[model samples]
Target: MNNIADRYLLHAAFPLSMDNESKSTTEMICIANKKSVQEQQLLQALESSEQRYEIATKITNDGLWEWNLNSNQINYSSRWKSMLGCSNQEIKNSPVEWFARVHQADIEKLRRNLSACGQGDVSQFEMEYSLLHQDGNYRVMSCKCMAIRGTEGKIDRLVGCQTDITRHKQTEARLNYDINYDRLTRLPNRQLFIKNLQELSQIESSCLFGVLCLDLDRFKYINHNFGHQTGDCLLVKIVQKLKSCLRSGDLLARIGGDEFAILLAGFERADYPAEIASQIQQKFSAPIEVENRSILITTSIGIAPLTNINDLEHQESSYSLIEALQNAEIAMHQAKNKGKACSVVFESAAYLQSIAKFKSENELRAAIELEQFELHYQPIIKLADRQLVGFEALVRWQHPDKGMVAPGDFIPLAESTGLIIPIGWWVLRSACAQMVLWQQDRPKSKLAFISVNIAGKQFSQPYAGDIIAQILTETGLDPRCLKLEITESEIIENVNVVLSTAEKLKKLGVQLSMDDFGTGYSSLSYLHCLPVDTLKIDRSFVENIESNIHELELVKTIIKLAQVFNLDVVAEGIEREQQCDRLLELQCEYGQGYLFSKPLSLAEANNLLESVNN
Candidate 1:
């Protein structure tokens, strides 16, 4: 090895026609002849190394290239020509031919990197770029170049290898898709949705934009009744339905379980958000097959329009893309509270109200601490004898600062902030205590029970049963004489928890009533499964029962629905004598509203009780 290294060094110093000052032509020829053995050995080593490099490159499937700087010529191996989707005979051996095949956009980048390498600013050239294939489409390729400097320290030649990295690029893209897309629905996931929002916010455009945050109603019930596999099929059907309602540029993404988001753009009408939301609702309501069973579902949508890009930019520091999403979610909750299958747009006033809402939450805490809440009872009477059967307990806030605040104004704020948990407990306890007091004052009072409305959040708690049992024990009110009213939507949200709670409350001897029945997405199958004692007709149907026959039939159907389960039926908002007559004709078990007696203060309720008893 040492002898080979020494002989190779001598040949490397003077390869062919050396211009050494001390050597004549004759002397050089004689010396070259005498060292012929060493020259032959060196030649064999050089050929072997070249053969090894060629074999290694072939095995790796890399196409080798060499460019002659002086001649502006290029040499391509057979694999290099094939990489460009061309036959060996189809390519030309010229530097211009190689440069021409580069994609227009990538040409500048390739030039920049190569120029930097040639100037000795970088040691090697490496680039991942797109090169035009002979078939006209582009192929992703990875090419690396290095300068071969001559004895004069000048870049005399360039050598590089080109690899076809198209498969690698496809694999990377698939991995990215899995990361940013929902596996079940194939809709863009939350991360990609946020990225899309950020990009949209940064773009300069005159088109008005909005976001629709949609959540499927009664999704949990579906998930519970049907298996997860069926639930996934439903999700895919929903995504397809949503896409039918979208424009070319709009984006639809599944952002959470049973939740999807839509980005709206290029709208001329200011009411496009509502129209689009209605289209989405209509499309979603169409029958879809899940495990060969056709089912229909409704969506509650919340629209948040991007008002001013400049304002958004300013708000970005304090509120990022999440701000818009939160705004949409807030509006969605508001719509859900109104009823199922509804859409609500976020107004600037709603945003401003949030500030006031924060103050209201603090006041709510104070109200609970100071017992500023008052329970007013509205009389529920039997239609046949106008006899008092029960009283529905309604809470009121006598705010010292605001004089009086309506439940509509503050209850939502309380529900959102989870203040409803404590407030609801207080109402149950206060109503039960008052009922016990009224029974004591008028021993002959016909009040069967006090019905108090329960908030959804409060009812969803695992400890909700415990709270009611404790209230019944503390107030000494007979559990049979206390009724709890919960909305159908609440029962639908957490079916398992609410159903379990209802069973426990029943075991405690308390009656459960479904409030505002026939207004939500509760199926009869699900309703029958609940341990409910009564169904209260929503006020909307009762108010216009005479004006609309459909409303009449709906009310009648509700009464029959209760009859099938042998549950008591109560009609609300019976303001007119005709409405009372209509209820009597329908044989509704009980009725409540102005026709009976308005919601009353404790003193007013006691006076009424005494009057009825007399």
Candidate 2:
């Protein structure tokens, strides 16, 4: 019987004797019962499995789908239909329904992956793509699929799950934007600019390209006058104006606080970048309105043209895209030095000079570490008696090859690189120690003090007073015997900080001098407030004192002013007897120049001290 229950019942109803036919009938009934039991157990397990799968799909929010290869039909679970913002009846059970919803950009890739998996090239695959939702918007979807094989080891059906990853993708995009763009201006930042530049370097093209480095002139003054919030708002507005000046292919990035860089490409002429830079500057001619205030500003721009690697004469030379940007930056600084609100193009001469400066900077650092420097003393004499009273310590670089490099050649460089701080300290300590030795040698000498020039950077140090005190203690020299010379520009730039530092030094009994007076700011209004012991008339004023009445009168007025302030006057660069006589006529107390002696070595200075004492 087809029905196992019926067969078993019939066997039970009839009484059978011990015969072969009856034995066969009993065996058939037993076999049928066993088969029925196994089928029931399997049906129960399958129902339970379907229930678990339903719960799992709901919990994971994943849409499950199955495809029949033989029938060319697809069966999507209810969750899968909902994922596409569709009801069960609205979607059809066909491959067309799934493929039609995929975005055009991603459809081909999805097809390739599915084809590969079905062909046994890959057992399973996971891919992220975009699918169109019922709302007419595309959503990112992550799909995991596997191929089902038949007994012949041929793939017959594909089963997979789809997860809506639209929100996750949006978050990832936001993070990437934040990383690559500036927060205030919403422009690309330095890192992204560099990455794009590096990528562009790999491209082979005949079209010319270049970079422009820009810096807003005196941006710090704006931040100080207005609040930082206003500064930030102004930067945003400036970015808008800057963007209006660019072509579609050009990129503008804010590389620093007040610094920006532009990458220009596909231009045939070399001067095209300069033309664009001019446009950018012209755009800023009008004042920007920010927080009810009209603020005017200007920009300094530098342009550097990029040369293709193939065009280079030497392939082994060190040239990179980054160096191109650096060259542009150097040109920008040159523009600023030429008095801002201008643009400078990087030339081969400038590039060569930059290479030389870079080499010098490295050598300077080595020289500092190796102590390849010496101090020369220039006598500071009493103008009336031409008597030696003190010596100004001058630092000289004893280059092994160049020999006795000029201070004018390297001092400005040192200041720019901030290497002057350590160099200044070395000069200070050495001068102090040498002064003590001189005092011990000639106890009756009129040599009273040693003067050392202190750079603005060194003077601005918070622990300058402490360092000076330690040096004095180490050298066993009196603080009164050490004079620290600072420039007028340094005092005028940061008045309060300079005054405070000067007060600290005064407390340590160290003398202070305003060096290079009348050359910077020349504001007589703040001169009386300065806590300086001397005012050294600049060399420019002293050089013409002998012939020029105007210069002599200016020096006379300066000396008079010093007398009124009870400050000593030191006239510098007095190369002629007439200049010294004129300075003495102006009642200048001290003078130092070529007429007194050019800077002297230690041995020569000691002999002069001995002669003065004799």
Best by lDDT: 2
**Over the stretch 1-614, how does candidate 1's per-residue lDDT look in tens digits?**
34446666676647656666679989978877767866676768877987897787667688888877767778888788888888878888887777898889899999888777767787787898888898898899999999888667888678899889999999999999999999888889989998888877776666777889998999888889998888888888888788888888998898999999888877888788889998887787667878889888888999887754555666453344457787888789778888978999887678777667777788889998998988788999999999998899998999998866768877987887888888899899999999899889877777889999999898889898998898889999999998899998888888899988988999989999998898887558588689999999999999988778999999999998889899999999999989888888888979999987999988898888888888
- Which residue pairs clash in candidate 1? none
For candidate 1, the per-residue lDDT at 147 reads 85
Q: Candidate 2's residue-wise lDDT over 235-349, tens digit each?
A: 9989999999998999999999999999988887878888999999899889999999999999999998765645645454244566678889999988998999999998879
Q: What is the C-alpha lDDT of each candidate?
A: 0.85, 0.88
Task: Report how far off residue 602 is in candidate 2 (Å).
Answer: 4.5
Backbone clash count for every predicted candidate, in the order shown: 0, 0
Listed in order, each prediction's TM-score against the native is 0.55, 0.75
Cα lDDT of candidate 2 equals: 0.88
Question: What TM-score does candidate 1 reach?
Answer: 0.55
Q: Give candidate 2 misplaced runs (Cα > 4 Å).
A: 1-23, 306-321, 358-373, 378-390, 398-406, 417-422, 441-448, 454-476, 479-614
